[model samples]
Structure formats: structure tokens, C-alpha cells
Target: MNTDIEIVTGFLGSGKTSFINALVESTLVDNEKVLIIQCERGLREIQKTIIEDKRVKIKLYDAEKPLTEEYLKYALTLYRPHRVIIEHNGTRNLIETLNIFNSKALKKHCKITTIFYISEASVFNFYLDNMGGFLLPAVEYSNLILINNINEVGKEEIDKIHKKIDSINPYAIIIGVKKGESIKAMVQKEKILEEGFLKKLRIFFKNIVYR
Candidate 1:
């Protein structure tokens, strides 16, 4: 069986980092190694926090200016991970990134099992309005849609958001694929429930810096 490669792709404040943090905490058993191929420069604060506290085995890479096909090829050849989960830079062309990943250099090393397009719950409607432009492009660009922060957005908004995303692509995985507030919750050593203005600012900075 081909090892699953879950690529989390999204725009700023879209919640890719949180989703991965959730997956890591849930799926990664003690000592079971997982590689996080981060397409960001230097150390991201949230990622660092997860490293400091979480007991799970992880390999984090900044990818310099941003890891390209060559960098991915290098990682695959060097790391040889059994299961690879890449968190794509939101600003990058993920379709093209996947295409490059399938290049002769790295195709044998990895096969994309699923692509999660992580985004904000509040912005779902706005994205849908631009379906022909941004929404459709993002939808067509991914295999699954993960609407985050369901707790804050509540069931009613979540339902509407699901309809909006599904209307664009009925074939896409809508609900179970939905990854929410778990990112921040999972990363915390103490598991704090507090999400304040600073939290929003953190997310905003993360999106812009990573964008």
C-alpha cells in the first residue's frame, strides 16, 4: 500500500497549521515518527510550541525560501519517511507543487493520498461568492474541504458553510474532513480553551507571514 501523504493547503488564516497539529496529536502514537514538510522560512512560533511540548516523534523542515521540487526530492531521498504529510505554503500553486512532486525525481517516493483545503469557517460564504474566481479555483485545486472553528462558528453557520462548499463540489469530503479548533487546543501543553483577540492576531500574522 502506498503510504498516505496528506497535503494541507489553504490561504492565510485558513487553519492548515492547526489541522496538522490535530492530526499529529491524534494519529501519531508515541515513537511513531511523522515528517512535517513545512514550506515556510525559519521557525514558525506555533510549530515550535508543538515541538517543545508534544511527545510525538516529528521531523520539521523550514524549506528555506520555500521547498520546491528539488527540495522535496532531497527530503524524500534523505528522509525516506513511511508516511509524509506536507503543509503547503498557502500562496503557492499547490496543483503545480503536486505536479512537481510527481516528477521523475520524487514520484516513486510519495503518492498524494489526500489534499485538504483548510479555510476559515466565517469566510466560507465570501469564498463561495467568488466561486468562478477564488472559490472554484481553490475547490478545483483540492481534494477535500476542511472548515475550521466549528465551535466558534456554531452548528448553524457550519451547516450553511458545508452547503456552500458542497454546492461547488459534491464529490469532495465535507464534514469528517472538517478540522476545527483542535489545532490550538492540541498544541497547548496545558490544553487551554482560551481563544482571544491575540489568538486572531496570531492567526493573522501566521497567514500573512506564510502567505
Candidate 2:
């Protein structure tokens, strides 16, 4: 059976590790085997307790080394995991990593289910300016974009950021999250956002195409 791959990416200190840890703890039931390929070390480490689970395995790779198709293929063949999660480096080009996932050889073994981009709302604009075009690919390709540290910014500010993100990738499900928020709540929000967004987008496209 093909493994399901989830790519979690963001700028440095964007809470990708925290989000992943919360997600795994809450949703991964029934001893589901998970293989986590971490390309960068975050400010916070995933707790030792999470790793103690027999079903969860993690491999940390050097961020300087390119995450090539050959390496990914070898990892997949070796682990044969039920699901794969990549904690991608903030500085790496997301498109390049995604290309490896898109390769024919990798496709036969694993398929990418979702790409989640976690953005720290407070420093979003700074990164956008400093990183230049490096950040666009991840935002454009993400299935969901979570703007973390929402409590640090007001709703108006968050909305502005949301609009900016929407302009780039209207199809992505965007949500604002404060600390201590439940992942289940975020998942629920995604469902609602996706449904409403898709409905409107479909109507708008239909009108344009028909007109």
C-alpha cells in the first residue's frame, strides 16, 4: 500500500513542530505507524514522550544536504511507514522538495496528502520582505495555511494577512490560531472554510466562463 505523506513547512520559529506534535497526539490513534523526516531543528524539540511510542519513528537529516529523490526513495523503502511527515527546513525551497514527492518513482510508493504552511502572524511581513520570492512557493502550494500567534495580532491585522495569502492562493484553507487552541477546532474550521470558499469560487468561475 502507498504511504500518505504530509509536508509541514513554514519560516523559522513558525510553530511547525508544535503544530505537528499537537496533531499527532490528538489524531493519531490505534498505533498508526508514522515516519517523520525532520530536515531542520526547531527552537522547541518534540517531547521525548512522543517518540517513546513504538509506532512513531523519526529521522533527522542535515538541512545543508539536498533532499533528493534517491534519498527519499531509499528512506521509504527502508521504513515502509504507514504515513510520512516531513518537517521541512524554513530556508529550503519548498518547490524543490515537492518535486521529489512528485517524481514517478516516489509516487508509486507514497503520495502527498497535504502541505501545511504555518506562518507566525507577527513576523509574517518581515519574512515576506526579507525572504523575497523564496516564501511564495510554499504558500502557493499549501493545502492549508495556519497563521499562528493570532493573539499577538488583532482580527483586522489577521484579516489583512489572510487577504494577502488569499490573493496568492485562494484555494488554500486559511485559519488563525492562538496558543492553547485545539487542533480539532482548527480541523473543523478548515472544513467550514474550504466548503464556503470552494462554493463561492466555483460560482465565480462558472459565471466568468459562461459569460
TM-score of each: 0.65, 0.83
Q: lDDT of all the models against the reference?
A: 0.60, 0.78
Locate the minimum summed-lDDT window of 10 residues in model 1.
186-195
Per-residue alpha-carbon lDDT of candidate 2 for residues 1-211, written as tens digits (9 for 90 to 100): 5777888999778888887786666545453567898898778787687789887899999888878898888887887666788999988999889878777888887888889998888988677767759998988889888888789977788777887788899998887888778654776555532234453454345335433
What are the C-alpha RMSDs, in order, of all predicted structures?
Answer: 11.4, 9.2
CA error at residue 41 for candidate 1, angstroms = 7.8
TM-score of predicted structure 1: 0.65
For candidate 2, the lDDT comes to: 0.78
**Residue 119 in model 1: lDDT:** 76
TM-score winner among the candidates? 2
Write candidate 1's Cα lDDT for 48-138 as tens digits: 6557653423555664455577866666566544457777776665666667766765666567766778777777776667644644656
Report the alpha-carbon TM-score of model 2 versus the true structure: 0.83
